[model samples]
Target: MDASPLRDPTIGTGAAAGGPAPGRVVIDARALSLTFDTADGVVHALSDVDLTVREGEFVSFIGPSGCGKTTLLRVIADLERATGGSITVDGVAPAEARTQRLYGYVFQAPALLPWRNVLANVTLPLEIFGMDKASRLEHARRNLDLVNLAGFEKKFPWQLSGGMQQRASIARALSFDPKLLLMDEPFGALDEIVRDKLNEQLLKLWAETAKTVVFVTHSIPEAVFLSTKIVVMSPRPGRIIDVIDCDLPADRTLEIRETAQFLAIAHRVREGLRAGHSYDD
Candidate 1:
């Protein structure tokens, strides 16, 4: 794995259209730190972390449970405020970006309403945003198809498998067509076989949508397989330990996991994780 991540070509390159380039900076964090003042005393969640996620990139934050992987994602989503330093999404504050509907977030659980069917669940966000019923249904149908849940729209949450329910949750997050997708261990609960299949589908969906994804995960292989850039974080008082660039080709399959290149990247991630633990000792 490369120590420095690869820069997206569209970043500096000029766009033919008068609009901003496709790969402009989407998320920027500088000396970012967050602390939780609780009854148990102060909890340092993040410390002096600097990171940049470009437009249309798949970036995964991986670390042990106590690390701030999900915290970082929450910060980006404006679910939690940073106590120190500065951060921006689309060149604006996270709060402003959030108010502008700049991003959509997916949590660890599917979180679909039991009372609502797939199509209704998917279009719920649009309804809250006051989109017309017809347009909301149209977007719901298209996103359901994107997640391979087209015919299952009428199915209730109880009727679908765990993976299918998660897909519907994904569709809901995408209903408003957000520029960035913030996922916090979305597939962490699924069994290995189902997780792998969903990973494949997710890659295909990302390729088609080109939405900048900031994902949090604990699985090394999952992080390597899904991310163009893998950010490894340290344990408590979390900080970045390594940022490994996944040099593998974009169009990949499960079989690629057996390749030497794949193992090499995984090895680097493991080493980085080990190093973080050692530093904590």
Candidate 2:
């Protein structure tokens, strides 16, 4: 399967801005905090954090190391339980959401199997769930097209560039069309050029699919570029310092960064981060 644009190139942008929320609170985290009972006493990874994401919205959490951005994401995904607070998805517990496969989780790496071709990699989840072979292949093909990788479906993971591989990984995540997309530093390892392109494509994908997104990242510009809301956090006890709404237009391009409005918002987010901020130079 090879991908082609489904509608007008701009078709993907409207759903992100025009549609009413899908009427689902995809993630609700109230006073979320986590602590590990280590021999050296407790290490507080997060404290008193509150966040709520409606379906089809793109939200990003940005903070310094030890500020618990990843910790919060893990808690919401139910990979780690909160030492305090609550998380609900579709009015159900995070564990229930996990068991029902109500979301897709993307880690820092592409994590594609080395031996599998792109189509095969995307089909892996279906196999695990015991989906029928014909349906599995059909779903995988549609997903590959969704990510604009139909032509590369037969290529092995190693043959593709980093950006392509990550796109394939994202395709796999979307094959089931999970309601929420949980991303932890998905673009962290790529170069600036590759990262920017991926960010644009991801925004387009989100707009088209209307999937709720909760992304964790350390980069302020990255947060500012893709998020409707930016949650900034402080270190030590790891508390959220501020939640800033981004008022930029949804039709973002690299040129948007050069605009004053974009820089201004990014600046404010940095101020919220304060001493732990990156890119002060």
Instruction: Count the clashes in each prediction.
Output: 0, 4
Off by over 4 Å in 1: 1-22, 279-281
User: In model 1, how many backbone clashes occur?
Assistant: 0
- Cα error of candidate 1 at position 235, Å: 1.4
Which parts of model 2 are misplaced by more than 4 Å?
Answer: 1-23, 275-281
lDDT of 2 by residue, 1-281 (tens): 00112212342334333333233456788888899998999999988888877655688999988888998888888999988888798678989999898888888999999999999999998999899999989999998888889999889999999989989999999888787899999999999999998999898887788677889999989999998878888777888888888868876787798889999999999889885545445
How do all models score by TM-score?
0.92, 0.89
Which candidate leads the pack in TM-score? Answer: 1
The Cα local distance difference test for each model comes to: 0.89, 0.83
Residues 173-257, model 1: lDDT tens digits? 9989998899999999999999999999998888888788999999999999998899999877899999998878888899999
